[model samples]
Target chain A: MDGEQQYIKNVDADAELVDRARAGDLAAFGELVRRYESRVYRTARHILGNDEDAEDVLQDAMLKAFQHLDSFQGQSKFYTWLVRIAVNESLMKLRKRKTSRTVSLDENIETDEEPIVREIAVWDDNPEQRYSQGEIREILDTAVASLKPIFRTVFILRDVEELSTEETAEALGLSVAAVKSRLLRARLQLREKLTRAFKRKGDQILGYV
Target chain B: MVTCKDFLRELGDYLDESVDPQVREELSKHINECPNCWVVLNTTQKTIQVYKGMDPEPLPEGVHDRLIGALEKKIKSQA
Candidate 1:
């Protein structure tokens, strides 16, 4: 039998943590929580734009996932399943605040002329290489936070969380076309914003931080 | 010659590699001669690369203790 895909499969492995977790193994479940908590927390924070709500959603999602372990049929990735729950929980929090960013399907928010989309300024230094890791994190977090929620959610799913475009579409209840359209706008807008922040010889970048 | 607008219109699909071969060919040609268009393609690809490389932030101080404590309570109640 061709068994090259396994680096030698064992009965006990990280990949089988979900199955182990399903069998009422508390340690297994705890490990799964540790593995995914940061991602779940970040997804919540990104959607809700705050720490307190993200922490609540994280707790709720882990508890809910633990309670309903039987429903996780092992078809999709466990993290993806967990993230779907987290995203929904985050959206519920947004709705309660009366400012749900995801209530609509159509994202025609901009007229496309006020900011020139085509004239992208190439960075003088490769900014990722130029900045410290902490600075880069702040820069990216700020830029993403500035995006319209409609686009930010799509970018978070497709780009940050590494979900497939179709998976992102399904998660958000958006069409694949809408996902692509929103992702395009998100990437373009972030590029423009980052360019302004990092363009050559510019003291202009310093003040935004 | 495909206008910069034409390239911008198909930007998403081009990046996704979902464009028709002929249109893809035209876009490739347009990007070769168009500095502004090239900048769009370059910087946008870089933006996604940078974000995707970011490590997820770890749970903040003491949050893990509270979460696990709550989970343990729920598990004990189930017993």
Candidate 2:
């Protein structure tokens, strides 16, 4: 079957599972958790910046989702609803800490009247190939971790999880415009981080040659 | 004609296909003519693609089992 047909099939299956779980079939709920656990955990990990906290958030969110299963109106996908709970749980943890890691939406990338690429070396190597290197993956993780929470979460939802802009906005309770703006910032910041790391590596290679 | 500034501002919307058709056409036109903007857009797109391609860290086996076990216990207690 094609992608759309497969998606429909999955949705139908999920709906059945939701109905069963809502009717107090714990096994059905376990199946739902199995399907979504990775996604929920990853979102929480990105938001909370650690495994222990993310695991806690994951468990808490799952329990809360189970307890409130009746309130799930099916207006959104079950996965989206689950992610919203996970994100809220993660954010509550962040709020408990005194340090607020918020990115300014007003922060703008400087643009020239006539834009010119000055120092950006053309990266001709296959990014997919380069990404497989352990060091590169480490750099990516650090770069993503460095982003302020708001932008990082938007990036994780839109880029990492591959959620649609509308779904991301819904998940975060933000406007589409806000999601777009934050996503752009996140991409730009990540690009800058990766570029700098690549440049440093290039310089080191040159020095060793 | 969309200037580089306008293009930068709306690049995300253009990429997302969320902009008006006319604006998208204009942005496409600008990118076609502007090498710098082209590189910026290309690299940014590549960055997202690379990030997407990375494998998600698997949930540890211990944690996975514990989570399931805990949920099952909670359900039983409530029963």
Candidate 3:
């Protein structure tokens, strides 16, 4: 494996780092961060929806992880444990912040606010087409940004980070039913956004009401 | 009448394959017979497929490194 892949594999294993960190090896703890930093940061970013807050949450989460490292017996994977800490810390920070409240669409709505829709189109893999990737990613970023903090956290953990429902429930301190409920709602909201965008773009020329 | 709206409301669970077998069997039967419900099911299914296709946004450059650095610093200061 290349150095990058090897590093990723090491992180995924969570073996060497857990053992070393338990023994108070600072470098091993650093490796744990290397392994899960992006996930933690992204989860924070999605929940908090601001770079500065996400950064603060990331720092706090790191500190908490370090302080509580001893309690992390290998029952669950290291990332799951770490993520639970990070997500809870991030959500706590988010709750403390004064953010606007958004509505959850339990059923279809009649509003014109086009939910930010991300189109995941694959063209021939060309480095020059990086612009397209940025556009689609921005759409997803916007869609995520539009969600309520709790739903955003659930979606980011489940869909983006690929955490299972049970793990996500543990991380967010939500029941499995709550996780499933929020996930279904989040998926519906995201779908509405994309559907509106596609329909608008496709039927724009017709100009029908 | 089992309206399309009702079908759409349960569409999330149906798509997840989370509905009970009895409900699933009934819904399948309804969708098979009812064009409107079927349309709703098709649209909802296609919409979910599209959403799931979205790529993971790569983390901001230096984010991982910065996080690791911050973590290491915290661990060191405590030691």
Rank the candidate models, highest TM-score first: 2, 1, 3
TM-score-superior candidate, 1 or 3: 1
Cα distance off (Å), candidate 2, residue A174: 0.9
Q: Give the TM-score of candidate 3.
A: 0.72
Model 1 clash pairs are none
Q: Which is the leading candidate under TM-score?
A: 2
How well does candidate 1 match the true structure in TM-score terms? 0.83
- Model 1 residue A28 CA deviation (Å) reads 1.7
**TM-score for chain A, candidates 1 onward in order:** 0.78, 0.83, 0.74
**Could you give candidate 3's per-residue lDDT for residues A1-209 as a string of tens digits?**
79779856855668778888778787877777766777788777777778888887877888787788788877776887888887777766755664464333222332223222133221222322434666656666787789876667778787777777888887767778677767766776775554444443232221111
What's the interface RMS deviation of candidate 3? 6.5
Candidate with more favorable, higher TM-score: 1 or 2? 2
lDDT of 1 by residue, A19-108 (tens): 788887889989889878988899889988899999999999999999988897666667777888888888778777866344443546
* CA-based DockQ, model 1: 0.56
What is the number of backbone collisions in each predicted candidate, taken in the order shown?
A: 0, 0, 0
| Deviation in Å, model 2, residue B62 alpha carbon | 0.8
Candidate 2, chain A: TM-score? 0.83
Q: Is model 1 an incorrect, acceptable, medium or high docking prediction?
A: medium
Residue by residue across A1-209, what tens digits does model 2's lDDT show?
A: 99989988988899999999998888899899989898899889888788899999999999999989999998888998899899888888887763655433233434322222233434556554555578777888899999888889989999999889999999888888778878887887887677665542442211100
CA lDDT scores, all candidates in order: 0.80, 0.80, 0.66
